[model samples]
Target: MRKKTPLNKQIYLSDHYTGNIAKTFQREKDINILQWDFSVEASLVVKLQIESLLNYIVKNVKSKDERRCKYLLPLQYLFRYVKKNNITDILKMEIRQEKEYELFVPKEVKKNSGSLRKFIEFCRRILFISNKEIDWSANVWYVEGLHINPKRVSQGTPILSFSFLDITNSDNRKALQEYVNYLICVTSMKMNTIRIRQTYARDFFRYLEQCNLCIFDVDYQITVKYMKKLGTQNLKSQSYNIKLNAILEVIQYLQTRNYIARFEIPVLYHKEKEIHTVNDIYNIDEKLDILQKYLYLFPETLRIMCLVLINTGVEKGKMFLFRDTDFYWEEGTSWLRIPGENRSIPIPSILYWIIIQYMKRNKLTFDAQLFHNERGKKYSTASFADAVSKQCSKLGILDGEYIFKGSMYQRELCRVLYRSGTSLQAIREYMGYSTEEVVKDIVGWKDEKVAIKTQEFFEDEKHNLGGKLLMAKHDKMKEINQLESLHKVDFALQEIKNYKDSGRIISVTELSRKTGLSKGFFYKNDRVREALDEVKNEQKEEQLGIIRKEIIDYSLEKQLEVYKRELEKTKQENQLLKRENEKLKKALDKQTLQYLKLLAET
Candidate 1:
């Protein structure tokens, strides 16, 4: 069933898509032609995807019994819908897009949406292998599909979708896929995490497209705008943080590859995560007391296991796998060797005696299962915890809810030990953890209120250096040096002012001669140097001002002479106008007299 082929052979020819898709895969004997319902109206790219997908399934599906149409139907339903809706880019299709065709397809294929997701995951991987960037450049990828580890993901493998609200650019769509590739291959992000990341990434891509921006155009300001956009959506603080982290990861990747410049994003949107305060840890003691009150209700083995869990707070997995050699005596003190820890933590004396008694009564050897079911098989962590929760429910704790989950007791114990004055290093070893971070969170190591108080204390004293000096135990030698320097600076400044007032040239040499201070004092002392420079600058400014005033006065005198000549010209023009008016009046009077004489003659 397994056939090894060259990586090049696995790559389908892009030219093969031009011809009939059926004829291209007719020679692929493993493919069942009847199962494929290729409509005549299907476009070229859709036809190519359908053909490539069949070939991929044939190569990957190993057992003959598993090669059924049901396994292929989910993607087929998706492709048919894609073709019907005239979608050209399969890479832009989302996992939940199949729901659009739900009314058109049978309910069985709807149930197979999970399988469709797995197929999409396969597509993403193969796309990465083909282009090394998940660009989806080719119609098909040249790579083998491997099974995902079931233990890595819970609730089946999580799937990602690329269809965003406004992702119109083809390259940006491919870039989103490339980000998915980075998450999968490079970061090994869990599918559940990818799903969450994909949500924010989709929002980001849609945002970029809506703003008519590409990845290269993203900057701190652009991210600020994006944050404002998220803010407008009225997202929760935690949800907003997820959005920030998702976009930050994308921005960092683009910057690393030189697609965008690196810039710091303001963490204004950041809100502190809710943590278990010391009071919360104290409150958990009430539940512990309840469990202790109902301790005897369980069978002896379960009761002892419950007691050990509550007292030791070891990880459930390691506790379930505990053996006879794990418990020992060190210098008359009882110690329990946690698996994976270099040193052992001391156990309660009474609990230690009970464990020793249980081991002896069971006749357990050094590698034998100390705690087991009736069949003597090792008990699972899940089953052991379930038993504890069931017994607690019968005793009426937290309304029948299983509150004692993974590492709850361990976290509680870490906080308790830390508050009880145990060092972080001791707590880390006690909890079988490799670092203090685990216990750090449980103990609320970074106190925001304390940090704020410290900051305020520093800020208050920041400008109060006088008070600091006054309160300090003074050294006579330091004070004398300071006084001498201050005296020299004062004397040099006064001499510079005297030189300016008396109209004398001022220089470092003149200052030194007047004040009997070293010439270096005027140059070396900051205050003296500044005062000297200021006086010299003022003198130069005064001389420049005088010269500027003389220049302005000369220009004003020239302008006054021009105004006098223009006034004389205006007077001559007015006199000419008066003479012309007199001549016209005389002519009118002579014409009137001539008309009067003519009238008398008639």
Candidate 2:
């Protein structure tokens, strides 16, 4: 048989036990005595008497005696104590019935009764009341020292509170009182993003509290409630869904703190139609013109920040991290280096100059933050959002509405540049995006025309034709020089041939020997031999036609050169004639003035 584990002797006390055990016992004894006739008549005298005794002990036992009372006393012992004390006939029957109930009750019910029985035992052990002579009536009457009213809690308690009391009391609390202030005072996020984050966080918490559940016990029902509430509030589905996501983050935080047990948060779906519609470029231009008026009053840092955001589409938080060292300016190229991803973005020269002017006007030192507050601290995302909202409101752009920071503006600028023929790769590098999707969204195109044009411009046959023409001209000139030299040699050979024709025969081998020419030299002198043959055949029948063609080609080249010179002379004459005509007109006007003066004098 397996050995049974012993039961724990420790007794737990609940809210009921704030008084002395003796007084509680006496009250139970008195009630039992008064109700003895009814208890016996109903055959429940013993059960009723024991129940009263158990209630008394649990309610009034002192902290020290509480444990002993719970574990030592038995129902039979209580009956023996009543009999030994010679308790009245009325009480005897009632005590017997209590003993019978303990002996015959179901095990489960008896186990519950055991707590009361244990309390009595503990009282007996602590009070040193002998089991044989214990006066049940006297013990019951000794109930003067008990008091049992519960204390009321006055302050409101958070249903899902954590121990952030110390944090609340901290000095940073003043700075962190508002979401915007916290972001500005503690973190290095842009003001605009901080506002966005704050709006999301607020919407989330509001949704949570709005549902009547504690943050800890937020369930599917509460989520459903929030969804219904959101619908009733007439918020755009997208905006509502965004707030739901932000709220879910807070719920996740709660889960981390052991406040909630399950991960069953509901996700909100947004309709496509709920997304903000974009206006035309004309409206954007008008808005930009209105925004420019505020640049004079706003700090230079904020002015440049707005321009950079509108032009570049960098996230507001990322813009806060930008430093002067991030900019690379050399050889007419200006690029900004983004950390984290290590991407470099080329900026427009015009925007670069505007940023330089803004920096100079601010009297800021080089390497100082490009976008900072009066204290030279970067604006947090929330504060930047608030500032943007306020500026938009002042310009009548927002009109108590929320507007996204860079998306629409970036899309518009990208489209304009793309349509004007900027390359896709250039746009990708300019926008600091890792992928081309954003660029594609901004400027839809099958291919970049500028890149194709640049490629063709550099490598096209037409562009290389000038170099080819120069090479061909040089080759032709070299060939002409070689031919002329061969013609001179041919004339010398023809003179020797003339001597041979006059019966003074000169063999080729003899001519080669006389000129000290080797076999290789003879082969190379074929051009000279050919020229000599042509000279000899100059008066021969049909061979003169070939000579005549050569003469015609030489004459045509000479005429072309002469024509080019005549064309230059004609252009000069045209210019000279124009100048002479202007001078004659001036002289005529002068003579006419002189004649008019003479006429007036006459």
Candidate 3:
């Protein structure tokens, strides 16, 4: 009979490893070891794999839960069952086969076998191949494995998978690796962006494999076929555009680097299916009201987060990056500083009060994360969004009616600010955007409202003015008949020219006083009125012309100053050159005189 292996000996219990998760890891080991059975050499092998997985979880898993030791259960059960049945080989077991899994795995441990399968997958991806520093040829590549930080996130790190590449097509896989590395090292693209681009590229690679082609074989026809395939997937217009653009960017990169021949991919623009009617505008207001009313029902963290989002329009990714010091009081108003921006936006006093209370309740420090999960880990954007969605759903809010996305709150805030008469420039500054282009889109509906109201106002005023003019017509006719009988046309024309020359205000009253004509005659006589109006316009034009000439003269003066400065610089340079020329000539003359003297002496 074989000697029973000690549990402690079979599994590594290094004190140094205890420093990874400190107390939680040590406690988990103590609790889990009580459940461990006899440890054979096969069990030792399985434990080592489990140790590696645990190390990965400790370092990379976003969850702060302490019960991560459960991942070890499935492997422990497998190795014990194998030893009990006198299995010949531990490593050769077909755990993926349904019959073999059902036979080898116990009923209690079967549920966790999925996690075990993940471990096996992890092994196949990382270990089974050449056990070097980095296996570039592997199907899955981890950002950490390539010695990249990839920026820590509340969500786990990004992993790039190349399994879509055909196994025989190692050349394509290598090219893909080079492209991804270029994105990481040369371009320094955000890891999330790189991951998404890799996903798009992978989908294209998978499509190429189906068509029995490779990346190097891409051309205009392949692009068309790929687009047709994407069309069949029933993707939304914007989503389809993004995927199309991502693939095109990859193809362009491949061509730019001379890996593939240059070819034109058809430039396609996606038309959005969304059309905002008046009803949609009404719906947005209704949703904003609903959000404010039912806000108390949200989870505490999400509630404060949404309030900040609605007020400041901070981006989702930057939402959780806020520190307690990010909020400060300036000019007796509370301000929130945007991360990575030099500016701060004012927040409502009530919102500020709420945030302060929340900070006090949570006992957050100056530099500590203001928003975090229950375990004091920063909450991922996806997790926070899901939480908000779930809460809203519980309150009978449908996704179509009002989703609690961060961007939705942002757009709504922009709409509110614009309607409150905030300028686009101010909005851009408050939102920490370099341009107002996106803000214009969010607040664009207000322009339509303004235009409609203005047209209605003008239409109403036109009708009222027409009625007033009709009522005053008889008095004007009586005055016009009197003026025609008096024959004062020449007199009125002379008075108008005098007014123009003296730069006096030309009106009917002034003309009536000078020419002894009725004001109504000046108003009603077409020729006299035309002459008066022309004189007034000419005077205004003369003033404007004087101003224009002044502006032109000032501009010419500026140009002249610039030319004079250049001329002065040129004169200085010429003087320096002349001095040097004179010095050289004197030196040459002196040398000639010395040569002549030397010839005389000879």
Best by TM-score: 3
TM-score of each: 0.40, 0.34, 0.51
lDDT of 3: 0.64
Reference-based TM-score, model 2 = 0.34
What would the TM-score be for candidate 3 when compared with the true structure? 0.51
Candidate numbers sorted by lDDT from highest down = 3, 1, 2
lDDT of 2 by residue, 112-184 (tens): 4455443443443334232234333222211111110111110111011101111222222221233333343
Model 2 Cα shift for residue 51 (angstroms): 56
Alpha-carbon lDDT of model 2: 0.50
Tens-digit per-residue lDDT, 205-300, candidate 1: 887888888877888888887777777777666666767777888888877877779897756544436343432433564566566767788778
Q: Highest lDDT: give the candidate number.
A: 3
Poorest stretch of ten by lDDT in candidate 2: 153-162
Instruction: For each of the candidates, give the backbone clash count.
Output: 0, 31, 0
Native-to-model Cα distance after best TM-score fit, residue 359 in candidate 1, in Å: 16
Relative to the true structure, candidate 1 reaches a TM of 0.40
Residue-level lDDT for 426 in candidate 2: 79
Over the full model, what C-alpha lDDT does candidate 1 score relative to the true structure? Answer: 0.63
